[model samples]
Target chain A: MAINRLFRWITFSYLLFFSLASVASDELEELVEDLEYEIEDLIEQIDERNKRFKINGFLSAGASYSDSTVPLESTDLLDEVNFSPEAVLGLQLEFKLNDKSKVVTQLVGRGKTDFDIVAEWGYFAYKVTPALTFRAGRLRIPLFLLSDYLEVGYAYPWVRPSAEVYDLAELFSSQDGMDILYNFSVGSVDTQLQLGGGTLARTSPSYGGLTFKATDMITMAALANYKSWTLNANVATVDFVADITGTLLGDADNTFTSNGAGEIKFDHLDILYYSVGAAFDNGVWMFQAEAIDTAYENRPGPQIFPIQRAHYISIARRFNRVTPYFLFAQNRTVSASDRREADAILAQAGVSPFDLARVFTQLLDHTQSSWALGINYSLSPKAKLKFEWKLIGSTKGTVGDFEDFAAFTSILGGQDALDGTNVYNLVFDVVF
Target chain B: MINKINSLAITALLIASPTLVLADLVVVVHPDNSVSSITDADISRIFLKKTDSFPDKNKATPIDQKEGNPLRDAFYSKVTKKDAAQLNSYWSRLIFTGKGTPPKVVRNDKKVKSLISKNADHIGYIDSASVDDTVKVVFTLK
Candidate 1:
């Protein structure tokens, strides 16, 4: 598989780099001794210089058990207690060439990716001025406030960010791109502005094993901080494309496949996403909330592109080393008209009764909400242990993001419809 | 004899209270640096790496005391409005994102003074009792 090959390549590259660094350090040690330099001072100098090029990382392992099955392609939520859903190890290396220029790279191995190493970020940054910076190469898409460090579990209070809000935009977290950032102050208010453009592609089983590609992806963000409060607004637009092959659609459409297996191709599908968020953290009490709206246009075939909206609010109060938090999140799809049009198209195509029902369910507008209560206990400055219990409820339609309603019903042998489920998670996160 | 012992204990408690409540922490820069005084917010910004330059437009290189030092904890809580653990978490975000790095760390007040004496742009903090001509006190957090 391509993922297996990529994993092997990354492992080999890390070994090669380590071997070369060891040899170089040995040679430098001999030279320092030969010159009769003060060994202690020379060693300190070497350490000081090495500190400029820093390496840091984080590891998170979590186990989750849900009361009912939320089944999807390739994975199910209620397969007993499982750890693969939220287990990852990330390593970051930053090389500062000078005061104004640096290179940074982060590699992450995730259980969901079959433990394959993937490059999360690799970028070059240059400081144009004290307040202005430019970065190029692969970078995180600033779609949400926590987009930059979404995978770094130790950076946030939750075992995971709310699935209702996070999973909807999870497909496009990174882009091969360039961005400009500027930080300035206006009357005691610290403000930052970022503009970026890039290309991105990812394949996900949530979307029926289809590969989504976007071109000319543009993003902009503005952030302002005053005292203990921070506010952020973000907007992004992209031209998306995807090819739906017969293998992906499977036997769901047997009549259409009989006529020489045609592929469903969508080109120049435009998508726009906008979000605004605010956070208040004053060392004791913390509050965060965000609302996002996503719109899609220009879809071909019987596919219905819906306008999706999501919001989440979380509050936590610190008590010494322990913090308990509460979160409420909701997601909805607004596409009743589009769903009716898709149903009409399927009916005119002479689709079978079972296949037509499946397609119709996939296009239906759905709503889901979740309420979570959690506690975070700091084991140390760099480590934390968290426990969370969440209750999720959904309407009868297709529960689109992490759990699909159709799949849940199918897993239940079509005897019972899934309306709600409880999930429990325990996680250990550390940064080094 | 019991009264005499109680009187001695009271004197000890009175002496220790001032050290806990009045540990004078002073921010310092090189003696040659033109920045004579800085606001508490500016000191916090410089130490947190929110702003890279000082008020006088010179490049600023902030230094920090080694971890576990009382002076370090006091400085962060008073100026940055964060505890040591909170500061660590804050820096972790910046470090992992490649946005900024934490300041260089020295062992004690003597090393802080030594480092500041060599670099005009260097900034550090020390106990007020350790203030010397080698470093200029820019802001005092007491």
Candidate 2:
């Protein structure tokens, strides 16, 4: 009787335990289903949010070689075949909060800067209306037609923009401020106007890493489009200051210091700049031209600044997937009046004019003309291979864009020694 | 033999049906959209993000077929007058400059039509043959 009772008890306990286990298993499955649904919901939310974000990028990898030892143009290619001078990669991110506003950031890394990434553009844009927009933060100064997209080589027909106009504005590419853009259509023509102002502080690598500041800046830019033609004009002004030291000027530091100028500084200099550009394209043939002039005023020293002008004309003919183009560009700087004023100041200081002639020629007075012949072959819709052979010459002044200006001058002993230079560059540009 | 001939004819017709369908594109909007018809310039402006509203002051959201779609190519070429490379470059300029963004791209005409049919603000282009009562035809490309 005892054995039978124990057997019944064990059987009942086993049945109860099995029922409880089944119930717990059912709950576990339900919990898993609920968790999975929640995860799916979370993923769906993330996917929907991701749709409002975008990533776009552009890259240019190329090598440049110059015939002379001097690093020529803003490319800064020396005699030795080099790859870094012209290579660049950039990435842009945009996040749209809604249809009316977005945030954009562009980071660029250049071979010239040792692949150090820089935030070239970071701005918040708000569309007040369909025709008007307001942007604030770091923005590209609209000083030229391509200033907004200067680093994007795939957008243009040339491997690089014309150095004549770009080199002068390169240092002032972006500013921290706000701009208003108004776009409208008049009949069949489309017009766009941009006005902005900001301050800029940048370090000049060419000047031994000395820093310069520009304040009270203002810019007005306009563009008009009709059929195959586009015309744009831009004007800007700023007050500039540079803290200069003898050591930073390289070879000129000692010469100026020994001449009783302890430390050279340019303060409260007012500068005015303007540019006009036109482009025409009719599928097969394309033409582009731009002219820029910069004038400096309110100088505290006789050697403060000079008037500079630059212009370029380019024509391209597309043959199927390949395009062959030709460009002619000129850059000139005049400082004769400044030189006379410096001479008068030196005369009063018991210093000879001849002692500073080299200094003036090296810094203030120069002329450059470049003729480039190039071909662009579209590898794909987003990429191209470009080859450019440019001839750079000095018309009436020294070759001003070279890197080793003082050394080149000392070796040649005169401004006229550099007649010309031949530079060849092969680049691949892509946009995504 | 008659049955064989019938089957062969059906096969040939089936094989040739895709080519026979014309892909001429038509711009579309929701059935309840306020705008009845749109001009080519207005279509281009909407697709290119130049204007966010229609001529009637209604909010417009432009949708595009994914890149490399023939219908998209035809629509942009005919209306915006830009080829694939030119259009891409143009958008790249605007996007990189923080000026504008391209229209949201869907997979194909059917997707575009479905999306537009669901929202009055949505605008898209589709093949003429894909037009149905759910979406209104705003502009037809020549």
The interface RMSD values of the models, given in order, are 11.8, 10.0
lDDT of 1 by residue, A1-432 (tens): 434544555576557556654566566445434432233334446667777788899999989887765542223567489888789899999988898999999999987778899999899999998889999999988878788888788888898877677766777788999999999876557788999999998886754687779899999999887777889999998998776555434344343334322213456878889999999988889999999999876654444445788999999998978999999998888766655655555567776545634453354465777789999998988898999998776645455444554554453365433456777889999999
Tens digits of per-residue lDDT for model 1 on B39-101?
988887788877777876678899998886778888888888888667877888788888778
User: Ten-residue segment with the worst summed lDDT in candidate 2 chain B?
Assistant: B14-23
Best by lDDT: 2
Question: What clash pairs does model 2 have?
Answer: none
How many residue pairs of model 1 clash at the backbone?
A: 0
Cand. 1 TM to true fold: 0.82
lDDT of 1: 0.77
Q: Give the whole-model CA lDDT for all candidates, comma-separated.
A: 0.77, 0.77
Superposing all C-alpha atoms, what RMSD in Å does each candidate have to the true structure? Answer: 11.4, 10.9
